[model samples]
Target: MALASPTVAQAQSGTAAQCQTSGANSVPELHKEWILVGWDKPVAGQSWDFREKLGKYYDWEANDVVLYDDMSPDFQIARSPEEYRALWESSFQALRRAHHLVLNGPEVIAGDKLSTSTLEFAARLEPPESQPIISVRARSTLVWRCTSDGWRIVREHNSTRRITPEESRQLFGF
Candidate 1:
């Protein structure tokens, strides 16, 4: 499948509505739902119950699943769903509050049994005990496969950079 390039206008308009309408396919919609269930809602609710909510989106028994998250340590290459769960649970422990805002595409390329998408986002995170808030900008690419159970992520890579306080203020209105 060919990847569709976003127009300058579409690139600048990073609203949820824009994301939903940018692609004329079900993959984009499924991507949005995946993000909402896996990240957005749990983060918004400040809940650490990720394994349960995110279980359906992953093939826990698959041997080839992988994740690379830059924010994690050198040992953060999770090759199994259990390892990913541990990583997420560890991250959640340090966060008192976290909010993620989608900044760009789920620009997607889809096929009969496989699809991939890229997403850019900004996050505001607060640490426990009233520590100062931290803001980060990040991007991620996810590969999903159509398994008998449904669409499940088989690979993911994410990278993040800390945003300056001033930049955070500009982006998040703090």
Candidate 2:
């Protein structure tokens, strides 16, 4: 498929009518769903397409993300939508380069979206036949800018920390 260009979502409406008034103010479940769609697994060269998919769920224009308060240093405090796409591509490439052995999903986490669901899932990496798949959640405390197409992840304090089986037991009580 083609990559997501600056104009791909030009024809789509940036704001949904009803969504403009109510949904405009806060994050919605649809936003989460859109993320799931784009993030189920790392897409090779299809990053822009995924971003377009996410745009469908929002009534805002996705520009770039910027950060205010950050507790992580591995990522930048701000990012453009295009920048976010590039970051994803970088990590996905890393996984491939490492020949990582990954597991499939439900990819369940221990919490809900209520601030409790603070896990940022990216892509997991593991040794073949390992006891458990390492979980990597990509997260950013940056801001999302609304673009003509939809909500774009602009800023990021992205992190991909590995979770060991022992840690998983501690976090999930499994």
Candidate 3:
């Protein structure tokens, strides 16, 4: 579906919608929209086209609480792109039978660098528990940044849960 056309002022003016620094990084708001766009299509260039969305957020050193917290040597460093994609595919395949999706972006911590917005998502399953099939809706958040390349994802989080359309209506008002 086409996304709503909320003005930049409308986005930044809201509590959950603001991700940019008026003076420092104009990337937060950009990131928020990029995340929405990421859902609609591929982001940035095709450098990571081989990648699927599952573990793609690992491209950056951010986590969605399912993985490491801040300050893991693992988080401080990442595998080669090839290795990262392998892990992403593995995770995606593992999740093939589940439903719903959620991903949260990173909250800015310190430094002139911002941590991008959180990508929160959720989904449901067919069997409703273990050994279930993934046949439900999913949603996620993506963090965006203005890069030497262009606006791109920096961090994201993922999950799964079942939600009713009424709940979705309350969540995104879409």
Candidate 4:
């Protein structure tokens, strides 16, 4: 007999309905949904596609979204939808040029009107000619709010896990 695949395994064991079904009243499921649609899908997009998907999950009307990253000292603040569009547009371009992102641990908590997710992930930057791929791990906490449409992110704070210079050199190979 053939072994059941992971997708089939979850479905057959009733865990899929418990954690994959929308409207199933499961926190894990909602968390799973948010993470996939919010981060995973956007990172997988190319060129214009990433921007399109970024707008979907972000709350444009709030007009107070703040994105934090390790590369900058100040927050990447977007006070308006136009600015929001610009930030993500530039972000997608950088992602397209510099690195490939992958999502890892997503610990989520669903609340009455707001939810939070702590995501641990890494980006593998394309290296020079024949150098080994360089990877950097970071963690982000995302704040989500329920809207008439659905859940949307209102704030995001991302920080790189502290690494020594030697550790960075080893991993990134300078």
Alpha-carbon runs more than 4 Å astray in model 4: 1-46, 72-75, 94-104, 127-134, 161-174
Would you list the C-alpha lDDT of every candidate in the order shown? 0.71, 0.37, 0.38, 0.54
Candidate 2 yields a Cα-based lDDT of 0.37
Best by lDDT: 1
The digit string of per-residue lDDT tens for model 2 on 80-165 reads 44444444544433332111222222122221111111224344433234334555434533233343443433333444566676
| Model 4, C-alpha of 57: deviation from truth (Å) | 0.8
lDDT of 1 by residue, 39-145 (tens): 65334336666677577777687899998888776657999778888878766656776667778887988755677888888877777766787789989888877
Models 1 onward score TM values of 0.76, 0.42, 0.34, 0.56
Candidate 3 TM-score, C-alpha based = 0.34
Candidate 4 residue 50 Cα shift, in angstroms, is 4.5
Model 3 lDDT at residue 7: 78
Give, for candidate 1, the lowest lDDT window spanning 10 residues: 16-25
Report the lDDT tens digits of candidate 4 across residue range 2-111: 99998866554553232322363333344444434443423333454444645656677785666555644245665554565665555445443333233564677766
Candidate 1 vs candidate 2, TM-score winner: 1
TM-score, cand. 4: 0.56
Candidate order by decreasing TM-score: 1, 4, 2, 3
- The root-mean-square deviation over C-alpha atoms between each candidate and the true structure, in angstroms, is 10.0, 11.7, 13.3, 11.9
Q: List the residue pairs that clash in candidate 1.
A: none
